[model samples]
Target: MGKERDGAGQVRPTTSLSPSAEFPPLSAQDIETLRRLGEQWRVEKPARALPVDPELRPSRPGAARARGPDEAFRPDQPGELTATPAAERPDTSRGRFALRVRRVLLGPPLSSMSMLRERMRKLIALPVLSSDLLSSVAYGPEALLTILVLAGSAALGLSLPIAAALVVLMLAVGASYRQTVRAYPHGAGSYLVASDSIGPRAGLTAAVGLILDYVLTVSVSVAAGIAAITSALPALNPLSVPLSLAVIAALLAGNLRGIRVAGNIFAAPTYLFLVAIGGMTLFGLGQAVARGFTVIPPPPVPATEAISVLLIARAFASGATSMTGIEAVSNAIPALRPVEWRNARTLLTWMISILILLFVGLMLLTHLNGLVPRANETLLSQLAHRTFPHGPWYPIIQAATALVLLLAANTAYNDLPRLLYYMARDAYVPRRFLHMGDRLALTNGLVALSVAAAVILTAFRGRTQALIPLFAVGVFLAFTLSQVGMVNHWRRHRGSGWRRRAAINALGATLSAIVLVTAAITKFASGAWVVVVAVPTLVLLCLGIRRHYDRVRQAVSLHPTPTQLTSAERSEREMAQEFLPQRVHHLLVVPVARFDQAALRALAYVVSLGQPALAVHVSPEDQEADRLRDEWTAWGDHVRLETVVSPHREILEPLAQYIAQLRERQPDITLTVVIPEVVVNRPWQRFLHSQIERRLRRALRRLPGVVVTSMPIHLSEVHPQATR
Candidate 1:
């Protein structure tokens, strides 16, 4: 046995050992560690020894005990005890009660610093930035092919060179936006830029176009994604529309739940798709370098050669479509971290890099594969078959390209709601869109996107190319307005060396504007006109809404009045007061067979106040009135009671007759007519209740020698907490 010191400091439990018989004392460091462990253990232990007041416990599973500086009080149930006079009522405590619980779950109220971090996190999650940006990869390629297809198979060779130009321009544009992100990291994308720069109408126009495009983005992206899935699984081919809608619903649910969760879910697939395409591009490039210049050959086409400059400009316009959702990032600056500018810039850089790689990769692959576009067909699908050898990889490449095509609208899905939120905050749209639900998700905006997308999908019948002409026109219109705004913004701040930058930006704006004109002219009949019309209509709608809000504000003006009440009018009020009894001993009120709680409470209160109560009943049918009189006959000896009957079954006539009789009998005595009413708690509840008090009050007002007192008593027990 080992020897140990007992609590009394005496040696105990001795065991023979060859080693040292006495143990050394713990070192200072070891003592500290043991002390820390003991403290931690104490802190983690249950609060069994702590004093617990029996009254502090919850009365039931769902019940909460009140807490206050004073002892908590529970009011007696209605009818269980008589109410004391108002003068004698107990004073209720004016502080919140303590709650008895093992733990409380809540973060400290957000400080500005915390808020700034949350904002940045939310900005990154904004679907518009990621989904919208990635989706561009899908259709940006398609847009390029659609244009090249018009110029002929040989002209399609120029696709890469043109794409190369666009790619350089995209990088320049991306760089320009980097400045925008830093400058206006507060959010409200192109609309803010346009409105402040160009004017309200232009800004509103941009907002409408962006909003419409956002809706289209969701529909197109989901449809494209579905189309890609269908290409891989022929069994799911016919279910594209329905499956697309289901995917939209799932996305809506995910987004509505929380932006963070949605971000986590969509980010991996989106990045994967990006990497997969990037790898395909690298593989195709490697093939070209190894195999030398051998064209993959093309599918059947109308012509073997290229097209005109007008057609080429139109194709460029189509290719420029990829830039549509770029503004969505600037619009969502408020959602970014405290360092919103940095985060947005980083996100933009990521976006721009991916966009360049995608644009170049697809164009190069298309040229190598010898793909040509028909007036209506997709070139990626056509090119995929030619570029990749006729093997298992052939189906894989086709499937991936198609998937990218379908998800291209992902950018819009993210962007539009953010646009809606800003517009709503400005009162250009419904205020509901700005509401963030319990999970801090833009639930309303998500729902709106889902519905609008479904409608567009149904309207277009999921034809991807059919929506393309209308698509880029809005994007370019927004871009032009944005560029113009930037130019003006810089000009205003000319003192800051922005004048030189302004001129260059103005040139960019002019070029963008010219491109916009070209896009509109070329695609007007093709479908861009629909967007042009739709955008203006949205502007008008927002303006109309603003006008309505203005009218309401104007109507509710609270300006102070200078005029005071005349002495004669004040004397009239004095005269009315003179007629009231100094001490009202008795009051009369009509009673029905089925008296509501308000009426009973009013009567009980009067009786409890040591005043005699009078009851008057009017019945169109004498028998019905007599029956009610009989019910209250037992209490008639304690108070004055009267019943008036009408042979013609008219309530008004009987009430008039009774009032006249009361005036003749007690001209000097106070005749206070008590009117009881049910108070509804909710707006919808008001519609379900009767408006009998209104009509009765009107009738009482006509009496010359009468005092009407509205006695509103508790009906359904409305707790003070309930009102709060």
Candidate 2:
């Protein structure tokens, strides 16, 4: 055997002249037969051709059963060969599986400062965060208004005073949350606070409440804001609910784009809305004080019918909604710059300052501008017209305030997903919720929240008051539990120097819990049942999450010992034995018409491997057979040629039978079937020739004791080397 090159400078097949017969160069008809054989037996193993007859070889008694050689075997039938290995036994070790998981999720060091910065920016801008925060501002007033409604407008004179008190309470809560930001700065807010202070169950409960509140905040606020806009611009009146839903959709899409895009998009509106509300509050206050106004009133506000003292307490409890997003700064403390605690406190101050101004300013403007509260109209819109001196600023202020309220709901877009991401990491929610899209945003959570909020908005027709009482109750429940959890947390950790601080938290928890009960009872009839329902739902969900974690933990646990790698190695070794070594004598059956560059290449590869090769072709008639024989004699040079005549004009059957006869004469000879195959580079080109390849492979697979190899030529796969 000598080194040979195909047309492509790769391996090509050659033939050895039979000792007693001559060889032939393949013609067009001979090549066609070769191509058909190659197609049919492409997947079949070629038989190793040998010079010595198998019947002459001495057979051992036990080797018959051990080697499993059957006398009935045919080279064309692949299934007759018992050379393949058994299946690999699976390893069931937990440590090995865990190593695999780690290799996949946490690969080679790919992190850099730029990547970390990018991830941080993206997480901060997540749509869930924006939607979560903004949603709070929308319903923030409803709780206050409902409280005044139950307590009566006579107590409404005290609404500002009560709001002032609520502001103080909100400040305390905010301060306490600052500690949370410093301690568990994961943007998970209340869940972290409760989980660290109490346990995972407590944490999950807080998470569920926070999530529900975040969702409702988006729905309720958008609905109410739309209503406010409608009150100012009546022409947009028809689309109030749908338009609110539209805003939700747009925000959701923005979030899906990625966190950074959403953050940058929402950040401006969020701050602008904040400034607008702050500006309105100060402008209204300066105007009221400058005008020497003594609380102008258009009419007497309505009084609820002989409300119980408990009702009065319940009504007061509703105002706590003003504190809905009080913990947001703490929740998102991680999004701040370094020196997170100091930055958080400053941010807290800024947020609280703006919140206080908006709450007091809106209420005071309504009172000072003779803007009476109505069942449907916004006090802010009425105040905008009355307090702004009735000029161009009137429409602008009205629009600005409405826009501010709408944009406030965008905060929910940021908060909800961040919190859910944490919950998902803890295995409390579906892992999908933790997925970040290509844009590095929690797109799944954003879409889920958006759809959920839209459903609520549609279901309730965007009524702010309808969703109001339900809002703060769940939040305050978390607040109360968190406060109590903190008190316990502090007590357990405190030394001699912290006794006073512990007492203060104890008092705070005691007071908040009492207020929680009062609010729950007083607001129950006024749609507070929604919060009541939320608590149990959240509890059940947490329990379910715990169950899932436990189940997964149990499923993949490791055993004491593992089996060795003996079986697997043996199986692969047996599979490799089916292939024949080079230097084997064999008859090369080449269908001449099929003998394209691919066939020639395959023949070159087989012959270079030192196998004795022959060319086989079919003849249709006596004259054609004689002509083929003459052509074979002329092309023989050194190789032998064999010809088969088909009487019924069937190709595969006759060719298959000819290979069978050769296998019987020399069982050790490997019959190398040279098939020319077209290699297509493009996807569409594959559709053209795939069917013929499939049919050929299927028929050849049934042949026994044969190994088949396919040699593909680049017809269209490569353009004939680009001529310079």
- Best-fitting candidate, measured by TM-score? 1
Per-model TM-score versus the true fold: 0.65, 0.60
The global C-alpha lDDT for each of the candidates, from Candidate 1 onward, is 0.62, 0.60
Model 1's alpha-carbon lDDT is 0.62
How many backbone clashes does every candidate have?
Answer: 21, 70
612-654, model 1: which lDDT tens digit per residue? Answer: 4676667677788667666566435344556777777666556
Query: Which candidate's lDDT is highest?
Result: 1
Error of 2 at 13 (Å): 66
For candidate 2, which ten residues in a row score worst on lDDT? 15-24
What TM-score would candidate 1 get against the native? 0.65
